[model samples]
Target: MDEAARRHNEKMKRIKAARDRMMQDKTEEKGLIIVHTGAGKGKSSSGFGMIMRCIAHRMPCAVVQFIKGTWQTGERQLLEEKFADECRFFVSGEGFTWETQDRDRDIAAARHGWELAKAQIRDPAIRFVLLDEINIALRYDYLDIEEVVDVLLTEKPPMTHVCLTGRNAKQELIEAADLVTEMSLIKHPFRDGIKAQQGVEF
Candidate 1:
C-alpha cells in the first residue's frame, strides 16, 4: 500500500478496536447508583426523571419518600393512578424534620421505610429505585449509614439502578456512590418571598 493508504488502514484498525471495547463495556452487568444532593431545588425532580425513564423501558421501579407527605403533586397522583403496583411510596408521616423533633421516632420511621426498600432492592425484577430525600435522613442521623450502604452493595441485582435525592449527603455515602450530582442553589423564588408554586415545587 502507498503511504496515504497505510495511514488510512491504521486509523481504521484503531477505530475497530475501540468499537469492540465499547461493545464489551456495554454488555457488562453493572449497577448504577446516583446521588443528588446540596442545598438546592430539583434533586427530587432529577431523580424522578430517572424513574420515568426506567418505566418507559417497562422496568419495575420502587420509590421511598422521606418527609413531605401531605402535599401531593402530579407525580404522586400519576404514580398512584398509573404505576401503583409497580412502585412503592412511603412517607415519614410527620411532615418536615423540625415538625417531628423526636430523633428516636424519626429513626424508627426511617428504619421501617428502609426495611421495605430492602426487599425491593434485592428483587431482580425491579430495575430501578428512587430513594427520595433519603440522604437528608442519613445526614440527620435518622437512618443508619452502614445498613443503607450494606443494602446498596449486597442487595442489588445485576444492572439494577438506584437514585438517592436529598440535601447534604454524607461523605461516606457520596464516596460509595457511583454518580453524585450536587444541585447548588444559585437563585430561588423563595428568597424573594414567593411561595412554592403548585405542581412545580410540590
Candidate 2:
C-alpha cells in the first residue's frame, strides 16, 4: 500500500482495538458520581457538557440547579428547545447566598430541591444526574451534609453517573466522589470590574 493508505489502515486498526476494549468494560446499570468544585467558574458548563454527551448517546439525565436561579444561559435554552424530553432541569427559587442572606429560606429551598434531586439517584431511567451548584449549598450549610452523603451513597442506581458542581466542596463529599475536579481561577473579567455578561457568566 502507499504511505497514506498504510497510515489510514493503521488508524482503523487502532480504532477497532479501542472499540473492543470499551465494549469489554461495558456493564449494565452501573453508575458513577462526579464532583466538580473549586473557586473558579465553568462548573455548570462542565456538567452541561456531560449532559450533552449523555443526550447524544440517548441516555436520560436530571439536573438540579441551585443558586443560579434567574439568569438564563444558552445551555438552558438549548435543553429547553432540543432535549426537552431527554432531561429534567430544575432551578432553585432561592438565589445566591450573598444575595438572599436568609439562612432559613436557603436551607428550606435546598431541602425541597433535595427531595427531587435524590429521586434521580435511584432512578434507573436516568443515566446521569447533574447536581449543579450543590457544593455551594453544602459549603454554606444550606443542606444537611450527612443526609446528602447518605442519599448519594445508598440511593444511586447501577451504571448511573452523577455530576456535582460548585465552589468549596466539602472534604467528605470529595472522599465519596468517584471523580473530582477542582477548577482554579487564574483570572476573570469580574476582577476588571466587568459585570457578568449574559451569555458568558449566566
Candidate 3:
C-alpha cells in the first residue's frame, strides 16, 4: 500500500476508537429541549426536520406555528397531509406584525398559539412538540418569555421533546435548553435581490 493511504487509514482508526470511547457511557436518555435561533434562515426548517425524524421513529408530534400565521409552508403541507395520523398541526399567528399591522391581534394570535403549544407539551401521547417561530413572538413582546420558559421547563411531560425556533432566542430559554443551535447568516440570495423560492425557502 502507498504510505499516504496507510497513514490515512491509521488516522481514521484512531478517530473511530476515540469516538467509540466518548460514546460508550452516554446511556442516559431523556426528552430534550432544543432551541434553534439566530439571524440566518432554516430555524423553523430545522425544527421541522426534527419532526420528520420523530415521525420516522413512529413518535407522535404536535406543531404550533406562532408567527407565520397560517402561511403555507411545504413542511406544513406534507406533515399535515401525509402524516395526519402521526401529528397534530395548528397555525396561530395571523401573520407577521408588519404584515398584520395590528398589535392587539398579534398578541392575541401569539397567545393562542402558545396555548396550543402548552396543550401539546402536556399531552402524554405526544412525543414531540415544535413551537415554530415562537422566538419571534417573544422578541416582539407578544408573549411573556418568563412564563413561556417556566412552563416549558417545569410542565412538559417527561418524555416529550420540545423544540423552539426563531431569531433572538431568550437567554433564559437558552440556559434551560438541552441543545441550542444558532444559524449564522454568512450569505443569502435575498441580499442580492433574489426572491425566495417555494420549495427552497417555504
Candidate 4:
C-alpha cells in the first residue's frame, strides 16, 4: 500500500478498537425516556423517526399529539396506512395555543392527550410511545409536570420506550430522561418571511 493509505488504515484500526471497547461496556438494554426539545424545529419529526424504527422492527407503537392538531400531517397518514396493525395515533389539541387562545380548553386538551399517552405507556404491547409537542403543553402549564413525570417514571412498562418532543422541555423532565437531544437554531427559512410548505413544515 501507498504510505498515505497505510497511515489511513492504521488510524482507522485505532478508531475501530476504541469503538469496540465502548460497545463491550454497553451490555444492558431497557426502555429509554427520550426527550427532543429546543427552539429549533424537527423535534416531532425525530419522534416520528423513532416510530418508524419501531414499525420496522414490527414493534407496537403509539403517538399522542398534544398540540399541532389543526390539520392532518403526512407522517400521520403514512404511518396509519402502512403500519395500521402496529401503530395507535391520537390528536387531542384543537390547534396551537395562539389559535385556540383559551387556557381552559388548552388544559383540557392537554389532559386528554396525557390520558392517551398514559394508556400507551402502560401497555406492554406498545414498545414505543411518542408524546408529540408535549413539551409545549408543559411549557404553557396546560399539564401537570409532576403528574406526567410520575407516570413516566412509575407507570410505564419496563421495556417500553417513550419519547417527548417539543420546545422548552422542563428541567425536571430533562433530568428524568435517559436521552435528550436539543435542536439549536442557527438559521431558519421562516425568519426570511417564508411560509411553511406542505410536506416540509407539516
Candidate 5:
C-alpha cells in the first residue's frame, strides 16, 4: 500500500479500537427521557423521528401536542392514518399563546394535554411518548414543572422512553433527561423572506 494509505488505515484502526471499547462499556438498557430544545427549528421533527423509530419496531407510542393545536401537520396525519392502532395522538392547544391571549384558557389546555401525557406515561404497553411542544407550555407557566418532573421520574413505566420538544426547555428538565439536543439557529428561510412550505416546515 502507498504510505498515505497505510497511515490512513492505521488511523482508522485506532478509531475502531476506541469505539469498540466505548461500546463494550455500554451494556445496560433502560428507557430514556430525551429533551430537544433551543431556538432553532426541527425540535418537534426530531421527536416525530423517534416516534417513527418506535413504530417501525412495532412498539406502542403516544403523542400529546401542547401547542400548534389543530394546525395540520403532515407527521400527525401520517401517524394517525398508518399507525392508528399503535399510536394515540392528542392535540390540546388553540394555536400559539399570542393567538389565544388568554392565560386561563391556555392553562386549561395545557392541563388537558398533561393529563393525556400522564396516561400515556403510565401505560406499560406504551414504549414511547412524545410530548410535542410541551416545553413551551412549561415555559409559559401553563403547567407546573415540579408536578411534571415528579410524575416523569416516579410514575412513568420503567421501559417507556419519553421525548419533550420545544424551545426554551427548563433547566430542571434538561438536568433530568438522559439525552438532550439543542438545535442552534444558524440560518432559516424565514429570515430570507421565505415562507414555511409544505413537507419542509410542516
Candidate 6:
C-alpha cells in the first residue's frame, strides 16, 4: 500500500476509536425539546423533515401551524395524502400579521392554535409534535409566551419530542430546548429581486 493511503487508514481508525469512547457514557433516552430559529429559511422545513422521520418509524405525530396561513405546501400535501393515518395536521392562522391587521383576531387565532398544540402535546399516543411558526406569534405578543413555554417544558408527555420552529425564538424557550439550531442567512434570492416560486418557498 502507498504511504498516504496507509496514513489515512490509521487516521480513520484513531478517529473511530475516539468517537466510540465519547459515546460510551451517553446512554440516556428521552423526549427532546428541539428549537429551530434565526433569520434564515428552513425552520419549518426541518421540523417537517423530523415529522417524516417519525412517520418512517411508524410513530404518531401532529403538526400545528400557529402562524402559517391556509396556503398549500408540498410537505402538507404529502402528509395529508400519504401519511394521513400517522399524522394529524392543523392550520391555525389566517395569514401573516400584516395581512390580518387585526390584533384581537391575531391574538385569538394564536391562542386557539396553542390550544390545539397543547392537545397534541398532551396526547400520550403522539411521539412527535411540530409547533410551526409559533415563535412569530410569540414575537408579536399574540400569545402568552409563559403559558406556551410552561406547557411545552412541563405539561408535554414524557416521551413526546416537541419541535418549535420560527425566527426570533424567545430566550426562555431557547434555554429549555435540548437541541437548538439557528439557521444563519448569508444570502437569499429574495434580495436579488427573485420572488418565491412554487416547489421552493411553498
Best by lDDT: 5
> What are the RMSDs of all candidates, in order?
5.1, 3.7, 1.0, 1.0, 0.8, 1.0
As for candidate 1, its clashing pairs are none
Q: What lDDT would each prediction earn against the true structure?
A: 0.81, 0.84, 0.90, 0.91, 0.92, 0.90
Q: Which ten-residue region of model 5 has the weakest summed lDDT? A: 68-77
Point to the candidate with the largest TM-score.
5
Error of 1 at 56 (Å): 1.1
Q: Model 3 compared with the native: what TM-score? A: 0.97
Give the Cα error of residue 128 in candidate 1, in Å.
0.4
Query: Considering lDDT, where higher is better, how would the candidates rank from best to worst?
Result: 5, 4, 6, 3, 2, 1
Tens digits of per-residue lDDT for model 5 on 91-147?
999898899989999999999999999999999999999999999999999999999
TM for candidate 6 is 0.97
Candidate 2's error at 16, in angstroms?
Answer: 15
Least accurate stretch of 10 residues (summed lDDT) in model 4? 75-84
* TM-scores vs. true structure, each candidate: 0.83, 0.83, 0.97, 0.97, 0.98, 0.97
What does candidate 3's lDDT look like per residue over 1-202, in tens digits?
8999999999999999999999999988898999999999889888888899999999999999987755788988998889989989999987777898889989889998988888889899999999999999999889998999888889988778999999999998999999999999999998899998998889
Q: Write the per-residue lDDT of candidate 6 for residues 46-68, one digit (tens) a residue.
A: 89989989999999999998877
Per-residue CA lDDT of model 4 for 1-202, tens digit only, reads 9999999999999999999999999999889999999988889888888898888898999999989888889988887788778899899998889998899999999999988888889988889999999998999888989999999999988888999999999999999999999999989998899998988877
Model 2: lDDT to the true structure:
0.84
Candidate 5 versus the native: TM-score?
0.98
Better of 1 and 5 by TM-score: 5
Residue 85 CA error for candidate 1 (Å)? Answer: 3.4
